[model samples]
Target chain A: MAIKVAILGYGTVGEGVYKGIQNHQEQLIEKLGDAVEVAGILVRDPLKKRDVQPGTFITTRFEEILAIPGLHAVFEAIVGKEPGYTYLSQCIEKGCHVITANKVLFAKYGNELLKKSKQHGVHIGYEATTAGAVPIIRTLQELLKVNRVTRIQGILNGTSNFILTEMRANRLSFGEALKLAQDNGYAEANPENDVEGKDAACKLKILCQLAFGCTPDWEEVEVEGIAAITSGEVQKAEAEGFRYKHIADIRAEGGKLKASVKPIAVSSAHPLFSVEGVDNAITLETSLAGNLTLQGAGAGKFPTASAMLEDFSAILEKSLRTKIHLLSARVPV
Target chain B: MAIKVAILGYGTVGEGVYKGIQNHQEQLIEKLGDAVEVAGILVRDPLKKRDVQPGTFITTRFEEILAIPGLHAVFEAIVGKEPGYTYLSQCIEKGCHVITANKVLFAKYGNELLKKSKQHGVHIGYEATTAGAVPIIRTLQELLKVNRVTRIQGILNGTSNFILTEMRANRLSFGEALKLAQDNGYAEANPENDVEGKDAACKLKILCQLAFGCTPDWEEVEVEGIAAITSGEVQKAEAEGFRYKHIADIRAEGGKLKASVKPIAVSSAHPLFSVEGVDNAITLETSLAGNLTLQGAGAGKFPTASAMLEDFSAILEKSLRTKIHLLSARVPV
Candidate 1:
């Protein structure tokens, strides 16, 4: 049976997901022993010619995707809260599995959406919500099942990391670095989320939930972005034999989750100090594994899309099971 | 049907495998939906009276382990080339899945064993062979399946990392730091394998095999260690705003594999710089995923053991027809 999928946004990540799915079609088919196809793509501008295969049915309305017959899954690449939230909810309510790259949505409303997905008997995957391509979510949820995680720390935001790396390397001020990042396509025009630590804070919330099984309040996460740190401070830190890294830390201690996103003065010996440029790395300290770290491209078209493809694979596997658990009743927290 | 496992080598990593298997019993049951048990343990001293649970049949003989009726899997944690190699071959011949934590055996004899395992219709896993608990092998094999990997740069050995970290932070000489590492249980008495880059080189062979599907001649890999580095050089690099890191790099360029293991001057922009003290990190550059980095405890009882446990889980899943093809067959150049 061919699993039909609808992409909610035909942006960079969405296009990458489409391209990756097509490129690895043979291997994916061999792995799953089945076929998958992209049924429809929901684009804001249907007339916009994309780099993707031209025959892919493009639509402007969200309902057109939901209305597509035999749609088994939805890949939500649309960022922000309103329409992505509504579209994903509708898809889940209609019994379609959802694979999303929206960190803002998942961090804010994951608990709610997960609850709804459970009730509808579907799986909601947001692996691309954190590190672009690193399978940290699956690693924590599946592979590291027996391990009790103590702390989650790493470079979670790429734009901030890029800015910090630029500040440390080129001795550029935050503003100058931010401009360079924007010019390099590493940062969005309104780089508020990436600059103010909100991007990392959102990722921290998702990571904490998976590692600790506790959804931390985003507001409680102490955030200090790279915007506050001057080039002088970065140079001074180097002179003092320290590295300034934008670190997102979530510690599960004494039955409470304490989390923060900030620029920290890490000694040269610290693992976080070595993470440079726009790359993302996560160090997981667990009872069984001790300390494990994963690093990769935090955000990029291909990395994010590669993650989405994995989620697609997971959904395809789930579809093969006899008693499909699309939705389960929300467990009381 | 319950999948039975026999553990070979009752050392630190071996004990960790036992404890991890025991600790995650309930979760394993839930995930696998089957009963699993440790049928036997291969130990040098049967009467050592360690912290492991009672009733586990302990034996010093390879014949005894092979004789265990219905033994489905074997986890070999004994380090070295002789008995570990011989015993693992015996297990594969018996149609039992072989999971190993021995890097030397894998580096030298992986091809032969893999061929044998394929012929015998059994899987062989060596996730713990490199990077302790880090999932580099699996990441290369599974997560980045669609992407063509270009380069892999990592801090593959923890002992050398610890030594380098100490030399930089405390201004200790390489020899002095190595002494401290040995005293602190991070380095073996004969630390030549780690200090000379042989340990990392061996692990790099496995990484190259998975990442590029061609194992470069081990001798061709340019090897350099931190032994030649001094506190003065570390300070000199610091003065120039660069950090010294021991890095193993393998890249596929124009149908040829270029590999190297050395201590390089890394700017604050490289992901390998954040990897510190006994922790390992691998940065993979792929066509689809761009660049992805994974970091973790490169070596430790629990971390390595956690990897072995994952292999055990893989064995159980394979038994139930959920064959996880984490690695493709190495294509000979």
Candidate 2:
């Protein structure tokens, strides 16, 4: 049986997923025991004539993709909340499994979609929404099954991390670093989400939900980006045998969840201190497992798509099973 | 429904598994939706009174444990091969799921046991075999499904890592560090496996089996211990702003497998440079996900048992499923 899935956007991640599946077709089939095809792709401009496999369905209409016969899953790679939220909600309502890379949608509406997916008896995998393909989210889900996590701290924003690395290594000012990051396609034109710490907060919220089963009001978490940091501070920290890192720190202390994203001074002994460039790393302090840290690319086309493909494999395995169980209220299960 | 399991040893890892399961009984039930019990424990000296819950079964004979009616799973925490391998083989032959913390047995006979378990339609979880409680094996299984991992480098042996860290931080000689480690119970009296790099080789081979589906012959992989590393070399490396780390490296190049365990000098820019003491870390460089690193307490009573508990939960979930599929030739699925 050939598994059929749809792509909601033909952007970087969407293209990457398509190409990754094509590249690893043999490996995927070997693991899945069946072929998988991207049945339809919902792009903003279907007539744009992008490179796609022959007979690949491309449409601008969500209804057309939804109407595609035997579409078992939907991949949401579009950004922001409005259309993505509407599209994913409708997909879940239609009992379609979903894999998403939209962090904003997840941070704002994850709880709702998680419940909705459970209610509809479908899976929702958002592994790409947080730390690209680090598998932090899945690991957290595994840990939460048998252990209590005390704290989770990470470098969740790649743009900010890249800018920080540039500022430290090249002695560039914040503006210069931001401009360089933008030129390298690592940051957006406005870059508010990445630079103002909103991006990290979104990822942190998603991680908190997985690790602690608690999600903070996005607006309530304290967030301070690398905007206020100076090259002098970076140099001074280096001289003092410390490194300046933009860290997203969340801890459960006295039964309270406290989260903050800010530029913090970390010593040489700190794990996050060495994670430079567009990389992200997460440290999980748990009761039984002790402290476990996972580091990888925080965001990228290939990495994000790799994460989506992981979700696709999981969904395929579940669907192939003779029976499926809604084990918990959680959607990913 | 209730799940019945047995423990094959009453050592540190065995005791930790027993207590951890007892401690997290509610959590386990919530995740599994069924009560799971350690129905019997097979120890060498059952008459030597030890701390145990009231009504817990203790026996010196393996036959007694195997005879316990409806024993669904067996946990092998006993050291080395022989009886452990025989017990596991018998357990699988009897269609019982098995979870093992025995790395030597896994490194020696993992392929045989994996095939046997799959043929018998049972699971064999050895999460506690390599890199205790870090979830590396599970994460690798997840990654192998979607990504092409090119390289794996790890700090796998905690005793050697502890010695190296002590030699650097406390300026201790190799012998002094070994004595301190033995005094602190970090190293066994005959610490040849850990200090001679054989333990790490075993772990590396297991990881290779999971990550690459290629198990190198245990003796074929190059082995280099930290015994040859002196305090002078550690100081020189530190002076040059580098750290001497015992790294277990395995890479698939040109369609061939190359593996070695050696003490390597890593610059501060490297992720492994910051991993000190008994903490172990593995970095997987993949085609899609870039470099993914996982760091944690590699070996500890609680951590090893926590890894076992993870396997326990997985087996419970698998057993609860209505149908089981030997999806891949791989048994871990």
Candidate 3:
């Protein structure tokens, strides 16, 4: 048997998902016990020259993709909150699981969407929403079962960190570092979300809700971007044996949860002190597990696709309790 | 309905598992959709003083634990291989899922036992058998689905790492570091398995089997202990802007896997560079996700017990896809 899937965008992550399914179909089949087929792709312009699997349906209409029979999952990567959430909600209504890399939408509507998916007997995976390939969401979901998490600190935005790292490493001005990030394809043409701390704010909201089990008021989270951090300040921190990092921090202090996203100076011993480039790092301070730090590529085609694929694998594994990793039945001991 | 579980030992890990079950029953019920009760315990001496919940059965005999009504899972933390293997085998024969924290027994018998349990319509979880609380096993299981893992380097043994870090930071002799590790409860009195690199060898074998999909020949793994490192060597490495760490490395070289456990010098930017004390770290260089590193408490009661409980959560989650994290079914859009 083969599993049918769809994609909702034709950007970097969408292309990666399509390629990931095509290139690793054998592995997916081995692990999923079935071939995964990208049966349909929803793009804004069907006439655009895009690399797609031969004979797969390409359409600009979401209804055309949703009409596909036996669709198992949808990988969404569109850049907005409205249509993306609506398409995903529609997919859930049709009983197909949805996996996404859109944190902006999820941070706001994740509670409703997750609750809605449960009501529809479907799975929704957003591991790619925060830290691209870090698996923080799944880790928290598993750990929160038997542990009391005290605090969480993360370098959730890769662009901001990349800019900070560049400013410190090469003594580039903020505008120069931002230009370098754009030239290297690390930043979008309009890099407001990544530079202004809104991206990290959304990611923190999603992480905090999962880690603390409450939706915090967005207004209460203090937000500060690295735009105002001067080259001199970066050098000063370096001279003081510290590095400036755009950190998204959430902690419970005296029974109150405080959240912030800003540039902070950290010493050499910090887990994220050496985290450079466009990498993401997360530290979970839990009572039982002590401190756990996970680092991975914060944003990229393959990394985001990797998280979505993991979430898809999990959804399929749970759908039927498939014996992909289970060995054959043997005689009694 | 209440789920019944059993423990095969009553030492540090066993007591942690017991207390974890008692203390986190609320969270367990909230997550697993039913109360988790430690039904029975298999201890060496039944009369030994221990903290246990009232009305729970404690016995010296394995048969007594197997006799517990409605037993669902058995957590094994006994020392050595002989009886731990036999007892776990019996648990599988009785159609109960099994989780373990004994690496020595598992490194040898895991493949055979896992295959055997599959035939019995039961599950086997050994996350606690490797790095404590790191979740590397589960993370690898999920990532290996699509990502081609190229190499894995880990600080797998806490005692070895603790001693090495101490030797470097305090400029202590090998014997002095070993004594300090023992006093801190990081190393055992007879710490041959840890200091001699046998513990790391076992963990590396387990990780390689999962990542590479085939077990390498046990005799071919180049194992080197940390006992030979002098204080001068540690200082030399430090002076050269490097730290000597007990590293377990396995990478595919020219289509063949090379495995080794030894003291290696790593600079500041290395993922495991600042990993000090008893903290364990692992870096997986994957073809798709880039470099993913995870660090956490390497060896402890709560951490090890946390792994077992996560494994238990997975086992129960697979048994019946209860709506623990799922909300009430809602109307379609």
Chain A TM-scores, per candidate, are: 0.94, 0.94, 0.95
Per-prediction DockQ scores? Answer: 0.30, 0.44, 0.38
User: What TM-score does each of the candidates earn?
Assistant: 0.84, 0.93, 0.93
For candidate 3, lDDT tens digit of each residue in A105-142? Answer: 99989999999999998999999999999889988875
Model 2 deviation from the true structure expressed as Cα RMSD, one decimal place? 4.6
lDDT of each: 0.83, 0.87, 0.88
Best by TM-score: 2
Report the C-alpha displacement of residue A85, candidate 3, in angstroms. 2.3
- Of all true interface contacts, what fraction is found in model 3? 0.59
| Residue A216 local lDDT, model 3 | 57
Residues forming the 10-long window of minimal summed lDDT in candidate 2 chain A: A324-333
- Among these predictions, the greatest DockQ belongs to 2
Docking class of 3: acceptable
The best candidate by lDDT is: 3
Pairing residues by index, what is the TM-score of model 3? 0.93
Prediction 1 TM-score vs. true: 0.84
Q: Model 3 chain A, poorest ten-residue lDDT window? A: A324-333
Give fnat of each prediction, in order: 0.53, 0.61, 0.59
lDDT of 2 by residue, A1-333 (tens): 777889999889999988988888887798788778889999998679788878888888999998888878999999889899999999998889999999999988999999999999899999999999888888877544788788898999989999988888889999999999999999988999898888998899888887778766557888998898989998898889888888999898887888898989899778687788998889888778888889988888899998899888877776666343332212332
